[model samples]
Every structure is written in structure tokens, then in C-alpha cells.
Target: GAGVSQTPSNKVTEKGKYVELRCDPISGHTALYWYRQSLGQGPEFLIYFQGTGAADDSGLPNDRFFAVRPEGSVSTLKIQRTERGDSAVYLCASSSFGTGRVRNEQFFGPGTRLTVL
Candidate 1:
């Protein structure tokens, strides 16, 4: 199976708009995750999913940020009322085993760059 893939390599939007970023994890991967990276900073975890449910979403900054992995494969990160502070690279990752339980490394996508004005 292929590694994770994120659509729309780059996106630019005005403030207050809505945006959806997509991620397709490798086949058979049960664990999926989303992260945000700002310049000069490490990637920050946003949400994690096991199968069709979110196992952890504590890192999501606010209610305006959300993600879904309904089919346990393809996932989408939804952002509402976008702001300049939201500008960053959105990344998606996956592993064959669930987090905190597997010693295997997670595979990462190239990331989707989002810029808000």
C-alpha cells in the first residue's frame, strides 16, 4: 500500500472562510493522525483516530477545528472561521498499529500548506 497522501499541496484563503484538508492513509492502517506545523516550530499534534473514531483530540486548539475518519481510511480536517493564526502546514500521518501501543514509526504525508489572510 502507498503511504499517506494529502490533497491540495497548498491553499490560500481569506479570513473567516472555511477549508477542508483531506488525507488518505495507507491501506490496513488502523491509526491516523493530524498535525499542524508553523514555521520554525515542530509539528504539533491535533487529532488522532483509531478506526472510525477519534482516539484523542486534546490537541485541537478549539471547536473550530475538527477531523473525521468515518470509513477508517480517508480523513478530512475541517476548519471554520479561518484566521491568520491558522496559517501553517497541515500534516497527516498513519501507522499500522494504534498509537502508544506500537513501536513502529508513523508514516507522514508531504503536508498541505495553508495560508490565511
Candidate 2:
């Protein structure tokens, strides 16, 4: 894909259900990030992966939310025991993120809208 691509553009489920959101970053991008955006608000950082390891995950709300980038190119955000409060748009982004204080421009995906009822 020319840009970041996320699967299941929309997802709806009941509370307590588990959901997995997938993201494929642009080729050669070494950094991946996950975020959640609620109605009328900006995206909330969820996690950041440098290469195949999670460099930062403090943004996750709790243990119920997790993400992995096993291969360094694709990532999956798993939400367990979902709650109505979890309803939001999940966004994924990627960048070269080379060694430096300078942050590279991130390319974002369309996002997966998760609606919990």
C-alpha cells in the first residue's frame, strides 16, 4: 500500500466483547503508533513501536488494551473486555523515525471505527 492501511474500516460490538484491529504501515517505515479518538476530540496516543518492539505503551488506558508489531511492518491492537467507553476511532500511523530528536512526519491510516453498544 502507498500509505498506512487499517483493516475493518468499521466495527460494532457489544460490551464485554473482544476486538482486534489491524494496521499495515507503509513499506520501510520503522515506527508504528496506535491512537484512539473519541467524538469531537483529538486522537489519544495508545502505543508506539520502534522496530519489532514496543518502545512506549504508557498511553494505553489499561491492561485490556494492547498492541504488537511482531514483524516491524504490521501491528494489531487488541482490546479485551470492551466497554461502551471504548467506542472510538482507532488510528494507526507510521514514520521512518530515524535516530534523532527530530520526529519524522507520520503517515496515518483511515482508522477503524469501533462502536461498542
Candidate 3:
């Protein structure tokens, strides 16, 4: 079975530019998550979607970051006014419920590395 996938594996842009990163989760996954990882640091949770609506966006630093999963399958992360500090690997993961009400393991994509110069 196929896992999660992200497009434009690497992106290079200048400060103030806008960028959009896309993610395709595994089929039948009802929970999707977005995270950002910087050098020498663990991934920081950004936003999460239980379905079409964002369940938690508290991790978003400010007004510059946003994400959406309209169809509950594919998601897109939008960044505005990119800054050098925004350079990092954007990761996407998805999970679902398993038997006995347990939570399934979250499968992660390779991620899109964005470099802002």
C-alpha cells in the first residue's frame, strides 16, 4: 500500500516570497497532521485536521502559516512572507483508528524542505 507523499521535495525561495506545500495522505486516513522541523531540533506541531476543519492550529507561529484539508484526504500548507527563519522541513503525517478503539500509528511523508534565502 502507498504511504503519504509530498510534492516539490525541495523548494528554494527568497524572503518575502509565498510558498505552498502539498501533501497526500494515505487513503482512508481520517486524521492528518502538519509539523515543522528545523536543524538540530525535533519537529514542532503546526496544525492538525480531523477532517475538513482544522482541529488545532495553536502551533502555528503567527498569521503567516495556514493549512487546509478540504476533501479530508489531500492537504496543503500555505506560507506567506517567507522568512529565513521559516526554512525547515515540513512534515505531514496521517493516522486512523484501529480495532478495540486504539489509535493507528501515524505514517509520515518524506517532507518538503523549504529554504528561504
lDDT of 3 by residue, 5-99 (tens): 99879999999999999999989888989999999999999998998999899999999999989999999999999999999999999987656
Q: How many backbone clashes does candidate 1 have?
A: 0
Q: After superposing candidate 2, which stretches have Cα over 4 Å from the reference?
A: 99-101
Whose lDDT is higher: candidate 1's or candidate 2's?
Answer: 1
lDDT of 2 at 76: 97
Global CA lDDT of candidate 1, please? Answer: 0.94
Error of 1 at 108 (Å): 0.2
Give the per-residue lDDT of model 1 (tens digit) for 25-49.
Answer: 9898898999999999999999999
lDDT score, residue 104, model 1? 64
**lDDT order of candidates, top first:** 1, 2, 3
Candidate 3: worst-modelled 10 consecutive residues by lDDT: 96-105
lDDT of the candidates, in the order given: 0.94, 0.93, 0.92
* Model 3 / residue 94 / CA error / Å: 0.4
